[model samples]
Target chain A: MKEIVVISGKGGTGKTSVMGSFSYLGKSDLVIADCDVDAADLHMLLGPDYQRSEDYYSGELAILDQDKCINCGACLSVCQFDGIQSENGTFRIEAMNCEGCGYCQRVCPTNAIQMETQKVGEWYTSSSKVGSTMVHAKLGVGAENSGRLVAQVKNEARRHAKKEGKEIILIDGSPGIGCAVNSALSGADYVVFVTEPSVSGIHDLKRVTELVKGFSIRSGCIINKCDLNSQMLDELITFMADAGIEHIASIPYDETFTAAMLEGKTLVEYDKGPASQVLIKSWEKIKQFAETEGCLK
Target chain B: MKIAIASGKGGTGKTTLATSLSSHLSETQDVVLVDLDVEEPNSRLFIRGDQTHSQSICKQVPEWTGDCSLCGQCQEICNFNAVIKVGTQIMLFPELCHSCRACSELCPESALPLKPRKIGMLNQIQAGNLIFVESRLEIGEQQAVPLISQTKDYIDNHFDESYIIIYDSPPGTSCPVIEASKDADFVILVTEPTPFGLYDLKLAVEVMRKMKKDFGVVVNRDGLGNNDVLDYCDMETIPVLARISNDRRIAELYAAGELIFSTIPEFKEQLLLLERSLELSTVVDPV
Candidate 1:
C-alpha cells in the first residue's frame, strides 16, 4: 500500500483543511491516519465514532508509598529533576516532572519507591463518516510519549489498511520537526508539504524540506493562502524550483475554510467555493503524481 | 537573572517578545538572547549579528568492532531500534540513537564502544551588546534533546554576571522544551487570546508547575479574541504580566524583518515594567 503524509512546518497553515479535503477526494480504498497526537483536530472534520482505543505507555514513573515513608529527605536531595516534593510531612512525586531516571528510587532508604509504567496517551481506531477507517490519538495533558503514540497510531492504521485491503494511507502529520513528525515521515512513500506565503512560513517550509530530504523521500509542495503575499509566493516558487520540488497547487485566501472548520466540515462538504475548487484541482494533480510515481497500485 | 520566553503553541509571538524585551533591556543592561528553537529559530531575523564562533554538536554512538560473540543482548535492551541484529553481524543506525548508553552499557562481550558523531551545529553571534546563540540540528537526526542540552552548555560557558540571558524556546511541552526551560529563574509564556491559544497556554502552565518554576503569562494580540485568558489567570491566580494589543503595524514590521519594540516605543516601557515586576517578585518570593 502507498502512504501519503501531509505535513506543515508550522501550525495554522491549513494542513488539516487540505488533508480533510484530500480524504474526501480519495476513494474508499484509502485509510486515514491523524498523526498529530499532541493537538489532534482532524477528527473534528472526519467525525469519527471511536470503535476501540488502547492506552500507550512509553517509560516508567516512580511512585513513592507514603505508608512506608521516612521523612529523611534523601530522595529529594538526590533527585535530578526535583520531582519529589515535601507536602504536609510526606514526600510526593509529580507525575509530569518525573523523568523516571530512578535516582529517587535508589536513594530511598525505606524501599518505599516503586517504578510503574505511565499511561501517557491513548490510540484509537474509529470509523469515519467518509467510509474510511480513521486512526487518531489524544496525548494526555503534559504527556511525554507523543512520538511513541504517533507510531502506534500509524501502525494501527497500516493494520486496518491491510485487513480492509485498502491501497492508500493518507496521514495528517504534526506541525514541527520533532520526533512525532519523524515517526510520521518514516517509511512513507510520498510526502506533501502544505505551507503558507509568509516570511516565517517560508523559512519553516525550507527547514522542513531539508528534514524531508534527509530521509531521501520524494516530496511536493502546496502553497496555502498563496494570495497573501505575491512576492513571497514568487519566492516560494523559486525555492521549490531550486529544491527540485513539484509545485502542486496554490490555494487562495478564502473564508470558506474558517467557516467549514467552525461547522466541523471539510470544504468539499460545506461549500464548493473558489478555495474548495482549488483544493479539488490540487488533489487531481496529486492523484496524477501518485499514479505516475507508482504510489497507487 | 536569566529568563526564557516560551509557549507550547507555535505562532504565539515568542520571538517578538524575546527580541523586543532584549532590545528594551539592552539600553541599560548587557543582555544576551539565546534561540533554543532549533527546529525553526527566527531570533536572528529580528536582531542582526556578526558571527563570533561556531561549533558542531556531536553525540556518541556505539560501534561494533567485530570482536566475535554476537550475543543478542544489545538488540533486546535497545528500545529505539538503533541496533538491529542481522544474522551474525549487528547493524547500527547512528541517526536513531538517543545516546541512552543502554546497548553499550549492557553489552556482555564489550563488542560495542561509544563513538562520536556530529548531529548538529551551534553558532554564537554578537549583535552589539546582545549575544545571540542558535543551534541547528542536522537533517534526519532523531536526537534534538541532546543538542538542546549541549546548547545550554554553551550558555553556561559564556554566561556572565553582567548580562541577563533570554532564551527563545521551541514550541510544545516536550523533552526539548523541558531541557530549555529546566534551570531558568523565571519563565514567560506568550499566548494569544484565542481558545486554542488558551488551551495550549494551560498545557504550558502545567509543565511549568511540574518543573516547579515561577511563571506568568503575556497575552499577545490581546484584543483579537475574548478575555478568556484574563479570566483563566483570575481563576487560577496566575498573573497576567502584560497584554499586547493586536497592531497591524507591528505585524507589518515583523513581516518586514523589523523589531517591533524599536518601531513601537510604548512596548519598550511595557517590557521595562515586566522586568521590574519580575525582579520584585523574585526578590519577594523565597528561593
Candidate 2:
C-alpha cells in the first residue's frame, strides 16, 4: 500500500483541511491516519464512527510504596527532574513532572519505588463517512511521548490496510521538526508538504524539507494562500526548484475553505469552489506521481 | 513580568502580537521579547537588532565504549528508548534521547558513556529597550523541550526582574508549550473566532488550568471568524484581553513586515488597553 502524509511545519497552514479534501476526492480505497496526535483535528472533519480504542504506553511511571518508608531522601537526591514533593510528612512524586528516568527507582534503598508502564495516550480505529477506515489518537493533555502515539497510529493503519486490502493511506501529520513529525515520516512512500506564503511558513518549509530529505523520502509541496504575498510565492518557487522538489499545487486564499471547516466538512463536500477545484486538480497530480514513483515500498 | 503569547492553533498572530508589543512597550518599559518557539523562530525577521551574542546549546547522548558488552541493562532502564542493543553494537537514537543521563549513570560495565552533541543555539539581539532572545533548534533534532528549557533558563538567570518578557510559544498542547510556559508570570493566549481556533483555545485553557498559570485571551481577526471564541470565553469566565478587528491592513502590514501599532494608528489604543489589563492582572502575582 502507498502512504501519503500531509504535513506543514508551521501550524494553521491548513494541512488537515487539505488532507480532508484529499481523502474525500481520492478514488482508491485507503485509510486516514490523524498523526497530529498533539491536537488531532482531522477526526473533527471526518466524523469517524469509532470502532476500537486501545491504551498507549510510551514510557514508564514510577510508583512508590508508602509502607516501606525510608526517609533517607536517596530518591530525592538523585532525581534530576525535581519531581518529588514533600507534603506535610510524606514524600510524593508529581506524575506530570516525572520523565520516568528511573533514577529514583535505582536510588531507593528499601526498594520502595517500582516502575510501571504508563498509559499516556489512546488510539482509535473507526469508519468515516468518506468510505475509508480512519486511524487516530489523542495524547493526554500536557502529555509526553506524542511521537510514540503517532507511531502506533501509523502501524495500526498499515496493519488495517493489509487486512482490508487498501491501496493508500492519507495521514494528517503534526507541525514542527520534532519527534512526532519524525514518526510520521518513517515508512511513508510519499510526503505532501502544505505550506503558506509567509516568511515563517517558507522558513519552516525549508527546515522540514531538509528533514524529509534526510529520510530519503520522495516529496511534493503545495502552497496554500498563494496570493497572500506573491513575492514570497516566487521565492518559494525558486527554493523548491533549487531543492529539486515537485510543486504540486497552489491554493488560493478562499473563504469557502474556512466556511467548510466551520460546517465540519471537507471543502469538496461543502462546495466546488475555486479552493476545492484546485485541490481536486492537486489530488489528480498527486495520484499520477504516487503511481509512477519507484520509491514505494 | 513575563507575558507569553501562545495559541493552541498556529498562525493566530503570536509572533505578530509579540513583535509589535515588544516595539511598542520598549517606548516606555524594559522588555525582552524572547522567542521561545525553538522549532521555527521568526521574530528575528520582523524586528531589527544588533547581533550581540550567541551560544551553542549541547546535549549528551550515549556512546558505546570499545570494551562494550551488550548487557541490555541500559536499554532496560531508559524510559525514552534512547538506548537499544543492536547485535554487538548498541545503537543510539540521539534525537529521541532526552539526555537525562540515566542510561549512562546506570551502565554497570561503564562501557556506555555520555557524549556531547550540539542540539541548538541561543542568540541575543539588542534593539535598544527591546533585547530579542531567540533559540534555534537544529533541523533534525526531534526533542525541542530541552533547548526550550535551556533558553528560558538563560533568560531567568541573565535578565533583571524588571524586564517584561514576551515569550512566543509554539503551537499545540504538548511538552514544548508546557516547558515554555512553565516559568511565565502571565500568559496571553491569542486566538481567532473560528471553530478550529475555539476548540484549540479550550484545550490551551485546560492546560493552563492544570499548570495553575494565570492567563487571558486575545481575539485576533475578529470578524473573519464567528463569535464562538468570545462565547466560549464568556461561558468559562476567562477574561478577554484584546480583540483585533478584522482588517486587510493588518494582513497587508504583516506581509510587509510592518509593526501593527506603527502602521495602523488605531491599534495603539487597544494595545494600551491590553497593557493596562496586564498590569492589573499581574498585581495579584506581583514581581
Model 2 DockQ, alpha carbons vs. true complex? 0.66
Predicted candidate 2 versus true structure: per-residue lDDT over A1-297, tens digit per residue: 888889998887889889999988863488889999987888778889889998887677778898895777888777766678777768988877787888888879899998888777789999988888899988877888888789889999999899989988888899888889999999888889999887888888988888888888788889988888888889999998888778998988777777888899999999978888889899988877777666412
Instruction: Tell me the lDDT of model 2 at A220.
Output: 86
Q: Model 1, residue A262: what's the lDDT?
A: 59
Residue-level lDDT of model 1, residues A1-297, one tens digit each, is 888899988776778889998998785879999997776768878889999988888777888898998888988876645578888877899775676656567657899999888777788899998989999988765666567788889999999999999988999998778788999998888889998777777888888888888776777888987777667788889998998778998887665775676567888989988888888888888766665553211
TM-score, candidate 1, first chain: 0.93
Enumerate clash totals for all models, in the order shown.
0, 0
Lowest summed lDDT across 10 adjacent residues in model 2 chain A is found at A288-297
